[model samples]
Target: MDARYAIEIDGLTKRYGSMTALDRVSFRVERGELFGLIGPDGAGKTTLFRLLTTLMNPDEGTAAVDGLDCVASYRQIRSRVGYMPGRFSLYADLSVEENLAFFAALFGVRVADNYDLIAPIYRQIEPFRTRRAGKLSGGMKQKLALCCALIHRPSVLFLDEPTTGVDAVSRSEFWDMLAELKAKEISILVSTPYMDEADRCDRIALINEGHLLAVDSPRGIVSAYGERIYTLSGGDMYALLLAARRLPHVRRCCPFGAAHHLSVDADFDAAACRRQLADEGFADVALQPAESGIEDVFIKLMNHE
Candidate 1:
């Protein structure tokens, strides 16, 4: 039990019958740090969250939350750690205020007891506090869930895919809320499938198929990318994608928005590529050097795995 760390896991392992969800996962989150688990769907982010929140026990390895062992101290961990599951688990028929009150009561605390703690977030939806959770829009529902999760003022918070189906603006606002929460010194462990959200955290762990591929500051991982990416765009995106795979000296090609992001070896010549595309009956072909981003890093790591 290390008090300095908010959450600590050593060789954590979990499996579902034949499938291994997490393998030898080890990491330590410093107090008040915002840590993100970035990966795609089915990448075992949810499984790791469950193990840490004491909802389920890991088959192997040891986990501690705020100096409490996840297994031996399951009861205490549940009381001290707030968990907002990936899915909306609140009572759909309950009004916004009701849901918050119910969750508070579950912990034997009253909503007014932590009103100051949740005021920043709860105020956003306070006007609609009487509306049933199921009838609220996606963004409003998200806010309600967050308020319920925070009512207890736990030392650590676990948010699983908090922005999953929300609109762009809502997503932005949700991240802003997380930033505010982090300021309050609540250690947060959040998981999301969006690679772009990696930048919001102080540090991140990139996971895929039960393997913890990399962990570092968002910039640190991008710096390790080691390869320069060329953004290519032309009239025909599909044709460009197909043609990109055939380019000489090119190691990786993935579609990024309207452009095809490509990584190539030293022998690859940009001028030659443009001429080659022109020869292949493609016109207005262009290629520009672009800095590698988190998406590129994840793709590179997955390929190596």
Candidate 2:
């Protein structure tokens, strides 16, 4: 393992009977970096996190965390890595404080000893400390789960879709907390289905259907987009899409927000496209050049595969 690598995975594969969950997946996460495993559900993001956290074993290949083998040194890795699962796995009947204390005890640490580590997060939900984990709001549950994960003061933190069901404000708050954690030099590996969240990571690995698609910074992936993207919006968008697709240079057109983002061939002309749509009896067609984001790159990569 290179000295810079906090997590090293090579040719990692996992199978569930005949179903392949991961296929020769490989990547490296630098120490203290905020890395993301980005993809939609069933993209093997959870499986890869499970393998690195030592929750399950890979069928083939190997991985290491901070120089400890995931297979051979699972115990050491477990002690050194903090994991927040995709789902709410903490005890529901227990109060918020109780749940956090339980995890700390299991890790052979006291809540008081590591209280400062999770203080920032726990403080938000502190007033609800007496509330049962099940009764807490979606965002509160997320915060409590995170507090439990960090109670041990692990060197590396693995969060599996920590912001899935939370509100927008809470989601923003959670990412802010991650930034603070990153500053503390705690290497973080977070998985999310949200393409926008990819930008928050230092580097990202885009995966889909048990295969690796692209691995680079969010900007790099967006820059990899080979063609220009135009956002077209007008009355009867569905009809407009059909008309635009019939144009000579149209390569790919998909709904994005309230508009359709069209990728065109080199010979594609924006003026011609507008005219083509207008000539087709479409109402008030509009086209504006737009930048390719992570989601656009993801869709294009999945199509190629």
Candidate 3:
């Protein structure tokens, strides 16, 4: 029960009959830090968020938010935390203003009470105050949901895949809003499947199949990639992928954008690799050394697991 940590979990486990959704997962989020749970669907991110927000109980282990026990002090914890679920959970029939007002009332606070806190976000959607939430676009709905979440001004905010199904412009705007919220000293725990979003967090936990693969700053995680990687393009992508995988020195190869990123052993020979591909009748082969990114590290970890 460290008072300094905004959120803490130790050996947290959850089971659905024989299926383990979260297995001995553990992590700490410092106060005011923007921490990301980087994982794809079914990675236990939603389950973990539910456990921390006191909406669901963990089968084993313990968790706390803002020094309040998740199970024992759930009432208090609920009041101290704001949660935005992965799917749009707000009332679809209700107008944007109505939704915000209802949530504010539920917390025994008025939207005006925290007007300054949400003004930056609300202003964008204020023009559509009378529009039904269901009628709004993905991005507008996202903004409205955030306004309702912040109405009570909770110390810690939990956003579960808030950016999913959103447009690129809206996604970028949502992160910008999160950055502003973080600047206000509100600890944020956001989960996303996008690897690019991992770079925006102060720190991230890479999880897959109910296990935490790694937790560190984005740069730190990238630095943990130990193998030499090369990018190869200019040939038929599928053919190039098969060819690269067959190479003895190639440890792993996966399609990345227009190029295929291949991991190799220390003794990897660039000239020899090109010559071999040419001999295979692949035309216009191009290869060059490239740096590893979060996706690369994630692939490496998943393979080892």
Candidate 4:
């Protein structure tokens, strides 16, 4: 009910028969804040978004947007919030311009009314206005969807994995557009499975299996990673992983791109680990201390839970 928060959720719970999609999740997004919900698929990001956007009802608890109850004021909330689901849901048969116009009409507004708000994003696809939405490329479709969502000048926006299938260049440009929107004082709640995107948000809530592991600024989460982490790589990565896990001091060892992230005790001796790998017939074994990243924190939290 606080006006300062654009969205507030308290012990929100949702279930489908025997499966619990969201388990007592709770968080708050400050007005004009750009917050991220980071997790993998089946982590319940979409379910949470649906509940907050008034498209689905929760089995327990309550949620509010801009001081309006999501359930009681569902009609009002629908008008004030813009949502772009993970999957493209635009009219495939309609042209880019038509899709934009349709959404504007549905909101009882005209495209001209919010031209200034969506101009930055709309201009990119203006040249393709006559093209059918389904015929456009993935990135182009993303831009059009975003423009349609913003055409009504909503107070808050919910983007569920908006950059999932786009290329690297498009993803970068999409985030740039979001930055401009944030500057205009519109609150945004975006979810992503990509761990690298966590650093782009003001703060992030790390969720897994319908539970919130931690919520803090990206840097704060990394700083709170209490264990000493190191990178270990060699010619035989598979064998090296098995060997590292068997080490007495090593608590966790998981593959990280080319190398394995080894979580060891503070007093762990790197020299001893190297020697142990060599004794185990592992070749080209290398070990070095590495800084913990958001991915590291996420993996650690998931393991802890």
> What TM-score does each of the candidates earn?
0.96, 0.96, 0.97, 0.96
lDDT of 1 by residue, 1-305 (tens): 79889999999999999999999999999999999999989899999999999989999999999999999999999999998898889999999989998999999999999888889888999999899999998788888888999999999999999988777788888999999999999999999888889999999999999999899999999897648789999899999999988989889898999899999888989999888989998899889988989998898899992
Instruction: Identify the candidate with maximal TM-score.
Output: 3
Query: For model 3, what is the C-alpha lDDT against the true structure?
Result: 0.92
Residue pairs in clash, model 2: none
Worst ten in a row by lDDT for model 4: 165-174
Tell me the lDDT of candidate 1: 0.91
Per-residue error (Å), model 4, residue 85: 1.1
- For 22-95, candidate 4 gives per-residue lDDT tens digits of 99999999999999999999999999999999999999999999889999999999999999999999999999
Off by over 4 Å in 2: none
Summarize candidate 2's per-residue lDDT along 193-271 as a digit string, tens digits.
Answer: 8888998899999999999999888888888753588889989878877777788877788888899988876787888
Candidate 3, residues 177-236: lDDT per residue as tens digits? 999999999999999999899988999999998999999999998887545889999868
Candidate that scores best on lDDT: 3
Residue pairs with backbone overlap in model 3: none
For model 4, the superposed segments whose C-alpha errors exceed 4 Å read none
Task: List candidate 3 segments past 4 Å from native.
Answer: none
* lDDT head-to-head 1 vs 3, winner: 3
